[model samples]
Target: MKMKKKSATLLTTGMALTLALAGCGNGSNNNNAASSAPASGSASAPASSQAASTGNGGSAVEITFWNMFGGGEGDFVDQIIKGFNDSQKEVVVKQLRLESNEYYAKLGTALSSGKGPDVAVAHVDRISPFVKAKQIVPVDDLASKVGLDLSQITASNLQSVTYDGKPYAVPLDTHFHMFYYNKDLLKKADLLNEDGTPKLGEMTPEGFEKTLAQIQSKVPDIQALAVNTPYFQEPFLNLYYEAGGDILNADMTKAAINNDKALSVLKFYMDVYKNKYADLNDKNPWDSFSNGKAAFWFGGVWEAGVLLGDASKNIGAMPLPPIFGSQTHWASSHLLVVPSYVSAEKQEASAKFMKYFSEVGGSTWGKAGHVPANANVTASDEYKSLPYRDQFIEAQKTVKFAPQTDKYTTIVTTIAESLQNIIFGSESPEDGLKDMEKQINEVLDN
Candidate 1:
């Protein structure tokens, strides 16, 4: 949990190592950065794979659960699987860690070859291809037979996992972005109330900018914020949506990058970097965040994990501040999903264990830095007990999700690269957005 400040040299090494692994599908070994995509908001053609195998139910209803998270996260998933298997009389869950970065590629190969796990972890957009292929079964009936209602899950998260019309997975946690402020620094700056808690909701972009000016004057070594290009993407999208920018047309046939509202959001974000409100050049924002230098940053839950123990002393989070709308946060979820290749017997078993897996996995998953969406766990004493829970949970409720498509992963890189160029002084917001629209349309056309 002791995250070292990734120096230029260390970053070079890590990037070289991780980029090599990227060919194998991982962008980062860090789970918070590991994964996501959206449904096109339109229907695709029927699947090619046959559904409803007619036969007696298999005697062995062992379900295989494939996970990409390792280290503490992997251990936590294992514990959940162990608990489910030990507590249940009929279903057995087999949990496996696929070390390769090529998670989806390998998964695609496996499912097509009829060798994929019964319950493999796939992101929202990632499930589109599988769902269209009809490799996975619909869970409307599965949930009914087991008495687990899909209504319990957040509507957006549920919709992301649902293809044409059926639930394919249960979203586990919402990884929304929140603003982490240094409590000690806030107190030092006399921003705290008589009650001693820092007044965060009042900290608007302008108000926070003034605070940063004071922090800069007093703590010369600290940065106002550390800008991670990708971390800022969702917040920018949130701002775009608030400012009236749609990411794509309702049909998902055209990109909305050229819209005035989207361009406005992009310009505002680039201005943050250009105006010296944040240090944009750092390869890792958390380093600037953890070292007592960054005043505020929009970071994911994994930021909490790497800052476990002593590192947590200086950092605390508030919901993302609203720049353009009533909505004030941006988030994505880690969903618990079933694969197309999973046996019907295993799907039946998985349904029975969904809530339980969510409960047992909740505390640990949260401790690993995500906010659990499991109704049981979120209501539990442990979740309410966390310091940032109240604020973060509210933020999670309004988190935004990408348009889901089988091609989401492939499409994201174009947007990511375009964003990097705009943030790093390589392109203008207008130019960058133009590039984004072009690249996005190219993907849609394909």
Candidate 2:
């Protein structure tokens, strides 16, 4: 669960929205690192033996890296930095870990001022405006300079960061939702399969509800499904995407969320809340699921450490069922990018660091619960050894990334707020959908 604090006022376009989106950190900082660490003695060798020495008497090139990773993710990043620093001693990488809430604002200001980190982490969805504003530079040539083969990356992951036929960033991983179920609770409800999986019957909204109703009837005290009402956008996007809904039309010129597919998904969730299939008021729904008070959860791959770590928890994970039609679901990627303001030498150094992060550090990163974007890493036996990685990979295959629009941050924030109002009864679903469409159009027009 990537916890983002939305602003009260929407940032419509230009540099403001881009900066806000850039700072938006993905995933929760509450995850425990202990559960996500790689097995002992499994670290791979250095990604490159080539030196990143400055022309000045073989001095190491020093570069600053910026990111919003915290808790377990932050720990993994720290390890990667150490590994890169120790690998060849040609480049020294220093990191500045910022609080996610304030990250984009500062990054925006720094980029505008041409004085910030040489290397930084940006979400794929958030970099469009930066590209427009020329705050970040393309990485294809730089990657080649450092012997980093961009072709080794997953094609979709590579494509997400490409604009105008040039790659801007090195994608780290694809993060998305997984259906997690409590085996004990499912067994009590007679919904557990003989294979230790949930016997999810009939993959329709109504059929899924029937399964929930059974759990409610048999195991009366627990929440049958733990809906993420707090971060409602995630669960909303997951199912809406499955239903073949798009946030914008093909041209990316207008709002496209006010259709039957969107409405159906909204109503389905409303019904879930109304029927007590899930507790709408459970403020800490993630905690509820982790504490065994909920039978099912549409949790993130980033949660693998917490949800799948304990053998006693009896948790099982799989790709989200294709209830609405297809397995397509919402996903985002973490990308390593170089600011346009960075020197050519630093950009090359950044490229080296990015290559190592993708090639050598990828396995360690996968332990932090994201599906590594490196094709080689995913094919490696080490990545396959992780729990539920195959499911993560499968889910990653059909993910629908955010539309390539500069106004996406504003549009999505509006959707999040509007969906909340609709679900909480302040506005009817029909009215809310109309208002949301109008609001998005206004932003797009601006």
Candidate 3:
């Protein structure tokens, strides 16, 4: 269940090209990026005209789909595609599985050039630029045409894709970090409760640290907590969001991360490292937790398949504690979008695929460890039966999605790079905050 790492180089050069070409206007085919091969089991037939119909023995409308899913998630997608194809004859969805690191760049190029997959996957945070550039079409009318009930989608997930009072995409799943504890290690440290949950002293940050200290005292050999230092942004955002911090000002006109809340969160991580509560140098912290070398971890819900499915691991997951203030934490979603350049018929077909993905395929997607955006799927008895799904649902309720600014990609990347320097002592927290604020404000201004 390894997800692809975000490539900074691709994001910078690729998205820059996307925005530049978008500024030149749509329906251009000047870019020459190579197209990827279709996934196994997808149709290879040429796309049908907009007037084509699937009724009365008409040709099935062929539409190209693009996504970055791999490993276990990829398997689930393959199953979903097969189910959709077998269950009907109205539409045929051909898929192109792109390398995640290069996905956005290639997608940007495709959209700008008016050539590529008719439908594609976009992160909630990454779509702001696309929507602003009009590279993707609004899906509300298309969903309605396909008999997809938009009201059945999770409210928060739906809200995330809405721009200018219109839904630009159909959200598929909300993915975020959850609190995972090694039950066997907790039991050995006398921190496991009677019902197999961790027993904490209090809900405050200090109280949480004291618990970590106690774990160190009882089981000094293992890391009390495994902080994700490689992708430091997730852990940092989880706590900063809990502290009610914002990345931008009210109108999104400037930076807003230099306040006390952020400083306190950064200091908290510094203390965790200083006290040896977590190893600052554990590069593969997720593996450390998975291999039973860490007592606790803040891991993504997507990892549930490997961590929770195996009873031998003795893992128990719960919503992150309200240590800073509230349950709010960082979250992002995978959404289905139709490029604005797609034909109306293909847009309708894409909506049907989205409906199936949200309705019928959601349970299978849930098995891949994401909280399905379709409320009906989450409410199903089958979905409720999965391990720790209740906790996953609860955690999603308070998720703080990235701000809806076109500058988000640049801003977040800046934050990630600066935070790493701060955590590694390359700069003091105070100086780092000042520098990060300046950097973000510059991005916003541009």
Candidate 4:
């Protein structure tokens, strides 16, 4: 994923264009920059009038959908879309895939030009910018029309995509970092509890180190703690939030993470690699844990899809250890939203699809290692019975996200780079904090 250095400026221009065009609301065709065809879909359908359905008992309204998923997650989304097509006769959704790095840019351009897909998947964090710019309309009306019950969705996920008490998107799932342990390795270390969970005595830095040392002493050839470097930012942010600090000020105009609390959090993370409890150079944490070479793995819940398939390894998940005195975890979500300027039939069709995904497809989506955003789905016996989900599903109530600003892409990129520098020992924790604060404040100022 190539990230723009001047993403703050680029995002601002895209959003401004959206606000300007949203006022038009005339549903006129215009230039679309996202039709590069980097990926395939149902068909080469134009963003024109509603397509007449020729399938079952009635005319099915055809609607286009765009999404930014790949690998297993992509397959899961495709399966759900296929299920919808198979179970419905009133709507036909044409799904299009796009490169994630450039998704927002293309989406903003298309919506501003009145030529975007009728429905699209947006990150809960990224939807704020589109909502603020009015590129996506409020979906409360649609929710009401479809008899969608807001109480079924998690409050955090529902609030994440809402602005000024108005809903902008329908949440699909909540993805967060969780603690996974190899049950066999834990049993060998005598750290496996009777409940099939790891036996860490206490949730403190000293206690955590002691538990890791015990595991290391038993499995001398394996890493006691394994974490994927690419997703290090998630745990890092979780630590920051746990330390009673925040990523930005209330006004979202300045960085709020340059204080002692934040520094202490960074030092806590640095000590993990400094004391030799974990290897910072391990490139594949998931493989390390799944292959029984690692005792503990901290990563996104999405790994369940792959890890659950390893019959030789027994895996157990738990909420991240509350060593920092806070139960909060870093999280994000996939949300369904309608773009501005679309036909009434398209709106109805899109709303119906959203309802189906949240109501009918929630359980299937959970199999992809995501906690369903719908509360009923999460509480269902089928969802709770899934391996390792019961251990971490409670995290939805305390999950935290970065501030909602139009410059979100820039802020996260800057913070991720700073964390990587610290993890790779290219920069000291102090230097990393200074760099993060400077870069984040600069983006906020812009």
Best by lDDT: 3
Candidate 1 global lDDT:
0.66
Candidate 4 lDDT over residue span 1-446, tens digit each? 24665787789999998987885543332222345532222235542223344334447777889998999888988989999988978888887788888888777777777776889998888877777778898989998898888778988888888789998899999998788888998898999989888898888777888898898788788888886666677767776676668888999888987788777777776777786667788777778777888898876788886776565667877888787789887888999989878787789889999999999889999989999999889889999888767776876678887578888888888888888998888998888888899999888777
Error of 4 at 159 (Å): 1.1
How do the residues 1-446 of candidate 2 rate in per-residue lDDT, one tens digit apiece?
Answer: 12322332343344676766565532222221221111110111012112334333467777778899999999999999999888976688867777787777667777777776788998989999999898999988998899999999999999898899999899999999999999999999999989998998999999999999999999999999999999999999999999999999899988999999999999999999999989999999999999999999999999999999888998999999988989999999999989998888888888999999999999999999999999999999999998888888888899888998889999999999999999999999999999999999999999
Better of 2 and 4 by TM-score: 2
lDDT of 1 by residue, 229-317 (tens): 55556556666765656667877888876877777677666666676766677767777777776777777766665543364466677
TM-score order of candidates, best first?
3, 2, 4, 1
**Scored by CA lDDT, what does every candidate get?**
0.66, 0.87, 0.90, 0.81
lDDT pick, better of 1 and 3: 3
Give the CA lDDT, 0 to 100, for residue 188 in model 3.
Answer: 86
Root-mean-square deviation of Cα positions for candidate 4 versus the true structure, in angstroms: 11.1
Model 4 stretches with alpha carbons more than 4 Å out: 1-43, 46-58, 309-311
Q: List pairs with backbone clashes in candidate 2.
A: 2-27, 23-104
TM-score of 2: 0.87
